[model samples]
Target: MSSENDWNEDLFDCTNDCGTCFYGFCCAPCLFGSNAEKISEKNCCLMCCLYLVLSGVYLCWVPHYFERQKLREKYKLKSNPSCGDCPTTLLCSPCALCQEAREISSRENVRRIDFNGDNNQPVVSQPEATSDEVNHVDMRV
Candidate 1:
């Protein structure tokens, strides 16, 4: 985690990744939906559609801001909902989206799955106990 001053990508540096910037600029909703999927770890298509619906009323930034806050918290960036997150996501939504896309795409990212464990134990099943091995009680009087 970097310091508050050290963001993964500068908000103004949209040219950092031309592909993502272009995609985000062309289709902000698609970019935001993809970013939501990665951040929330849920259905991408559904999120895309949801963003599309939200975009119609310009309410998409609400979720986008929350997701940005999550990323900031997860990555240990500055937590400035009023000063940073709000201004960034609202004032410069496209750049903000591009910044998020760049951050997610950055190699510093850790993959969701890691095979770090040494799976050396072999699979084996326990034998079932025989009925004779069970304790018997005589209660007949």
Candidate 2:
């Protein structure tokens, strides 16, 4: 029942992704930074610091709003008519962060913990076998 242009996950469907919801609830700025970095190759640490500082004055939503807009533009996702990015980010940043995190994770094909975890294991792909690698048996022997 959803369109291709819609977001992979809804803004309020935070519970749908428990990992992102829990991580975002614990440290929203970090999640925001991760989303920003993955969305447009921005610096995660710098963004996180900025978000932390702005959060004190209740303006953390500013960076998040811009990031959301960028994400929408990058993915061609549609915005709700009644509730747009500004209002959503200003009122419910946690949810927005979770939603963005989910989108980034899905689009980038990366895990949530990979954004902040140091012990990240690399995904090793198996090499394909070439024609010369196959062994041929003697049938006349």
Candidate 3:
């Protein structure tokens, strides 16, 4: 899991994957919708429609902020305290969408390739052994 204070991928590192950048540039609505759906675990088409309709707001990034925050937490990345999203999402929505898409795509691909591949088991930590579970011995000779 990534826990950096910055994004797992650079905001303008679209050149890392040109396909995602092109997709975001060609159809921002779909990119945002899919990202919302992934973060919210809801219907992609429905989220897409809602995002498209609500995008006219000057502060449309409000909704996306929540979703992007969720993605950051899900990937264990540190939250942005600089309030940079106001520009990353509001002024450059396409680039933001591209970054989000790349993050999800990279995380999903890594998950798929982990532990013999296709094995998506959660790695839970076991509790420490307790005194009750320990064996006791007598020192009698």
Give per-model TM-scores.
0.68, 0.74, 0.69
Clash counts per candidate, in order, are: 0, 0, 0
- The candidate with the higher TM-score, 1 or 2, is 2
Pairs of colliding residues, candidate 2: none
For each candidate in the order shown, give its overall lDDT on alpha carbons. Answer: 0.77, 0.86, 0.76
Residue-level lDDT tens digits of model 2 in 14-106: 888898899999999899889889887899999999999999999999989999999998878899788999999999999989998988778
Candidate 1 residue-wise lDDT at 109: 49
lDDT of 1: 0.77
Worst 10 residues of 1 by lDDT: 132-141
lDDT of 2: 0.86
Off by over 4 Å in 1: 1-5, 80-83, 107-141
Task: Specify the poorest-scoring 10-residue window by lDDT in model 2.
Answer: 132-141
lDDT of 1 by residue, 1-141 (tens): 456645667787887789999999999888988988887785778877877898899887887889898777667776545557887777788889999888877724444334435784444467976665553333232
Return the number of clashes found in candidate 3.
Answer: 0
Q: Pick the candidate with the highest lDDT.
A: 2
User: TM-score: which is higher, 2 or 3?
Assistant: 2
Please identify which of the two predictions, 2 or 3, would achieve the higher lDDT against the true structure. Answer: 2
